[model samples]
Target: MAKQQLAVLITLLAFLGPAACQQQGLHICFNGWLKVPPLLSYLLCPPGSRTTNPPPSPSPNPAPPSGAGLSYDYYNNNGSSSYCPSAESLVKDAVKKAIDMDPGVGAGLIRLFFHDCFVRGCDASVLLNTTTSKDSPTDTEREGPPNKNSLRGFEVIDAAKAAIEATCPGTVSCADIVAFAARDASSLLSYGKINMKMPGGRLDGRVSFANETDQLPGPFSSLAQLQSSFREKGLSSDEMVTLSGAHSIGKAHCGFFSDRLPPNPSTMDYAFATELEVKCQGNEANMVHQDYQTAYVLDNKFYQNVRANKVLFDSDDVLKTVREVKQNAEYPEIWERKFEKAMENLGRIVDVKSRREGEIRETCWRVNGAGY
Candidate 1:
């Protein structure tokens, strides 16, 4: 009777699929011929029924499928460990060293990672320089107005890459290096408050175009615009809010947000607006901290400031009106936890639709054999 029931259950699950099994409040475990749901496991298998230990626990960070042409163990596959204790540690140390030399580098690294991943699946194409004429409107990604003078930390990435190359020698991909540096930069800037382990194995992309810069969300985007932008990148609304917390540690150029100053601005704090106007008067290049309370720290103060309408960017200010984000704003601890998970998700999204399409460039700035 038990054998008959087990066979029937297996047949049912065969057609139901994993999603259906989960919806029925049961965990699916595939073991060759036997498709056992957790609820029925004890009854079917009994005590020591043709078994060799229980199923393994789910991996905390599972590698994407091989067809994706990327692996979390990319460094291991490339023998990076044979060269050093751990390539990730080497990269982390290099990032810390760079930050030590320039305290303001964290924000740029974070932004660089964000921009790179958003446009082209984190292939590190953003690092490529324009092969076309410099004056041409169709310059490289770095030459776009949104990034022309604002995006930074390329030198820090180059430094970290040089250090990694000295140890691994063509083993690490620039995309993975950028991801690692960004993770380390966030943790270092936040005083070890937002650290998360990053998985490696990303490849570098060959193409970079200036016009693609328009895909990135701007400082003046509205709440709906921000949501649409993040969604287009496969990030959730919660993730969007969590990632936006990065604004806590960065500064913005006056030209980016100065328009909010004139014509009787209402969303901004009176004193803050006046200060910005005075500081930015006739000088669009002046920069100001995004979060005044904890400009250098990478904490939840950005959320607090957004709630108080003290944020620098119009897009950030609009987050308060987002119901889900507004609710999370009142609880910084929740945001921190969500932020960590969201950042992990951010790294994962960099892998989607990005395999076998590019190569690991010998140098980040130019394609291999392209000549200086």
Candidate 2:
């Protein structure tokens, strides 16, 4: 009698579409229905819903499983509204003012955030200056080959940090300030098209190393390599492709992709290759727009170009062949929605509590105690 009732429930769920199943808060959670008891189904998911996978358990007060001591309320000051609002507004206003003076600064801020996050989990380590002798081979992450002469927008972050320190003293961390600046820049550069609410309270990392940048994916990175890099940071392949849309704005130094040109042409379009060759003229220092069409706008045209085989970097081109990205390439709405969510998640990658293994740097360039 119990078996018959379970079979009836399964058949009813099958008849109900995913919409109905979701409305009833029920999920299938397994393939072999007979292996799962009927009571288990009710516990896993509510009735009238069918799903192939179990829903993620909610953690109302989650802590970082890695013991990094990060939390959503790491910066909370017991219902003190003044703490976050003042810092957030100051960072946004500073970034907006900077971008207004030079629109290109927006792309620089986005890239700066990536360079910082990819190396040392977005702790504003990239903003650190070389403390040792200038001629030394090993300096800071900012001086590394992957970053030197390539990364920009340090001054913008510096400006925002200075402004914030004036109002809030050492209450706001430079890491959080950098994150907020990047979010503001993204929204402003896209002309308010790609706005995302960023969570703050990240503590500043004290250590910065040039060698750690080996984790960063280069322009020549294969799809597998890019996926592996992002996966290590708790991001999915879909998110990797979504974040690559940032190429929609920014310029790349010609040296980064010159190897892809001429007799050994890679995935780049021939006409586009010829144009880049003319623009760059074999100069390593010369720069070209990552997306010539709508180069200053943050949009899905980057993916469209990738699909058409017109993007500059091999890494950007390969995103089109990824199954999940390929399907979403044509739908701007879908990609934009996914990209926003991914960006939000990316912002959380380095959210460490100030109380543990971190500090709120009085200045972005050096640790709080270390003298400039």
Candidate 3:
């Protein structure tokens, strides 16, 4: 590993401890790949890839899987009144305050939750309940259940609750707790000036999706597939790309798009595909997926790579309409503005009605692990 990367990895280990680092693999837990470290998370990524943080390591860690599961642990775990959010009126008040303070989570994760609920039916199972131990292939590929990294949103919310609980214990609802947490996390990224609305009264739904394995987007989607997927979830074509900006902070495992790279090239742009292959192959699997922290910086680099035709997926390339414009004199300007607007708008889809039909899972795994 590069000296700088090694330093970052070591620093993260010191910070998050060996136990937390052990449950590193989000996809495959193979050997040789670097364990997902807290600091150098971006090392495994192909600079511009966008599906997951790190890939599976050759010798994956042995930490207990992370994520929620069906069991009513969230709303009913600690104690109904203690863990649940406050009454609907209090939730509304808290949400109103939260949006102004942090809009990213309020708009992003909360909006994501709403979108998931509307399409597949309300079920927080769309949010990961816990780290799973089953094979990925076993999933139905339907909507909900395995939201992939969407569950990470819970991590951000947990942090927010740490602070909120200090001020108002048992009074805030878990649903509002997440809403506020999302807002705060967004403020951390947007400098707290973005326009956000907090929809309150999202009482925690105690039900999770029966198929919680699908619902999440992947790295290999075609532009059309992505458009259709997003549209199905109530998002527009423009919003799909905008939400992708969320990639500005996340990472993807190389395996997610290894095909997009050279040697095993798919239908991706040539230059981009070649570069991605080189980057993916060059890194040691152990060190690649082992790094997950560096994946969250929002810079112009991701967009530029897409412009260079070096992006990993067809979905990413579809946003490159700027390169396809032949005669329109206003294309570049319009594209730039639209891209920014979409991103901003993505952060603004907040409202109380957002939680119409969803229910939080007691356990994230399966509603009933038996035959149901």
Per-candidate local distance difference test: 0.69, 0.70, 0.40
Residue pairs with backbone atoms closer than 3 Å in model 1 (clashes): none
lDDT of 2 at 352: 51
Q: Worst lDDT window (10 residues) for model 1? A: 24-33
Instruction: Give lDDT tens digits, candidate 1, residues 1-372.
Output: 698997897766556544342332122221111223344543443322312222222432233222244445556654444233467877788788878887678889988988888776788878988443343344678976567888888987787778778876776778888888888998899887777766676788766777566557677655655665566666766678889999988788887777667624457887878878887885879998888877878888887777776777777888887666665667767777777777766766554444455676778888666776
Total residue pair clashes for candidate 1: 0
Model 3 misplacement above 4 A: 1-123, 127-153, 162-170, 191-195, 210-213, 263-275, 282-295, 299-301, 321-372
lDDT of 3 by residue, 117-141 (tens): 4333333334434323244233322
Identify the leading candidate in terms of lDDT.
2
Model 2 ranges with Cα > 4 A deviation: 1-84, 131-138, 263-266, 351-355
lDDT at 82, model 1: 28
**TM per model?**
0.76, 0.76, 0.49
Superposed model 1: Cα runs more than 4 Å off: 1-73, 77-85, 131-138, 263-265, 351-354
Worst 10 residues of 3 by lDDT: 61-70
